[model samples]
Target: MLNQFLDNISLPAATVTSATAEVQYWKEDLGGIGTVRAVNGVEVTTEAQGVISAIHFKSGQYVQKGDLLAEIFAEPEKAQLQVLDAELRLARRNYVRIKALLDRGVTTESDLDTARSTLDQVVANIEVQRARVDQRVIVAPFSGVLGIRQIDLGQNVSPGEAVVSLQQLDPIFVDFSLPEKNYATVKSGLPVILITDAFPGNSYRGKITAVDPQVDSASRNFLIQATLKNPKQHLRPGMFAQVSVQIDAQRKVLVIPRTALIFAPYGVAVFVLEPDENGDQMIAAKRFVKTGEERGDLVEITQGLLEGDIVASSGLLKLRNGESAIINNQNQPPENANPKPGNS
Candidate 1:
């Protein structure tokens, strides 16, 4: 009866042997939200106004350079070419006959010169007509995938009107911005990785291809572009991505398990262990600590903690200031602070 009463009155000894803090390497990485875009994207347009007689490319089809995409009505230009060709043949024969007569002393120099001038004039006119005819046929400027067509067959298209969109997909671009404070760390050739919701568990590796020299005065941030090889072409334009870059190779930091932290309305703190006044027992002391980056199961402690300090990793609420703590090493938590849900 006496032991049961004492146990009920006294504070139950909390399980204090489960958790620990260790000094480890904490790498500092910079990350920002970004957008994925095609390396070469353009809205294809027409230079000549006419009815779209035919569309040679299907929507989303891959086309090669110089492949015909569409054709505008060019009956007038074709007929003009035919007329010019006939005129050119006549002029060529006349020039040859005049030259032969001049050599034989049968034709005057002025007549031969007129014939030669007529031949050259016809040739120039033919070239101009051929150019007009070529403009009626729209061809792909580069190898790429064609987007949906804006104009349909038999539709009258105006000059400079967008007909379709083309985008190169073999390699893609990712555009992201970083704060001006990181300008010194970011540069062309720096490695980066991108994560997107479309592919949850995959990461695409890339390298910084360009960085804006001038920072935006309003935001104090500069833009950077990265090139990623998309052999599988899984990535597409306008996709939101999370960009990550390692700013420091090795960053020495003091880290503790996340379970050691005690969050409250006032501030964040932790329970640290120190020797009691009698030096015969250890007591839990509430220490207010300033934290920085958090990763997995570990968090960075920038202040109010030492590298080898002993802290209460769990049951922080039960352990308060001046509370006696029994340091039992049996069944301690894993040294790796990183959480592995798969292990559960």
Candidate 2:
């Protein structure tokens, strides 16, 4: 009964956190969703169908162009080559003998011509057989990092079957699109920044490499592609990324921490703190404000607040107009224009 009577005459002081309004120059950014892609991507396949005799490359191996990747059984093709070689040697000897006899006028010229023709035919047959053997050997078409191996030694595979995936990781491409209204704002050479959930707190920088010449009729959006350096291959294909580009020059803005704003149905307001007569306790005065754009943890105040003005950042429910405030700022909320949140 005594405590209630004392509270009616003079209310108890409320503890609250405080933050100061400031002017900061920041540029507005154009943001969009993007997808990471490899510069060169393909499923490596063999041209000939046969049993896998030798697996030259392991899974996830980095290979260069023309490097031996795998091999198919070609014992029969190899035997054909050996027989062709022996026949070629015999044909050469017979052609030489016929030429010598014709020069001595001991044999007819027609016999020499026939021998020469026989030698040419055998040489052609050997070339054709060698080409068949080459089709069995699988080699890398380009330099890239290989994916998981699909087949093992002695596992028969058909032609055009994928053995593994190959992708050139360095200098990867990021594909995104913007609305047609922004088509005039974006162009080549503009800087691009990308962030992904896979690697928080890390941002990749690049420049716009290409812009689609025309917008899609269905979506009414134009595609934008940028090239990012990925020497370590940290960025991979099919990764979702958040892309941003600075659209215009920086502009100054008056901002306060979002926590300072008192959200109400009628309007948004804040408790502006002013020194009382005693110069010890602060008087919190409620002032309605007009807000503009919002940054990470800060909100812009277009009206009703002056720069360098102190505002209540916490304890809004307890704060009342004309009430005294004990500014306890030791435990303040996060107040930053740009915040990087972790998955906690």
Per lDDT, the best of the predicted structures is: 2
Please name the candidate that would achieve the greatest TM-score relative to the true structure: 1
**Whole-model lDDT per candidate:** 0.86, 0.92
TM value for model 1 = 0.84
lDDT of 1 by residue, 161-228 (tens): 99899999879999999999999888888889898989877899999999998999999999999999
User: Taking the tens digit of each residue's C-alpha lDDT, what string does model 2 give over 1-344?
Assistant: 99988778867888999999999988967789999999999998978889999998989999998899999999999999999999999999999998999989999989998999999999999999999999899888889999999888998899898988999998999999999999888989899999998988889999899999999999999999999999878899999999997666787899999999888899999999999998988999999999998888999999999899999999999988999998999999998888868752
In candidate 1, which residue pairs clash? none
Worst 10 residues of 1 by lDDT: 12-21
Q: After superposition, how far is residue 109 of candidate 2 from its true place, in Å?
A: 18
CA lDDT, candidate 2, residue 40: 93
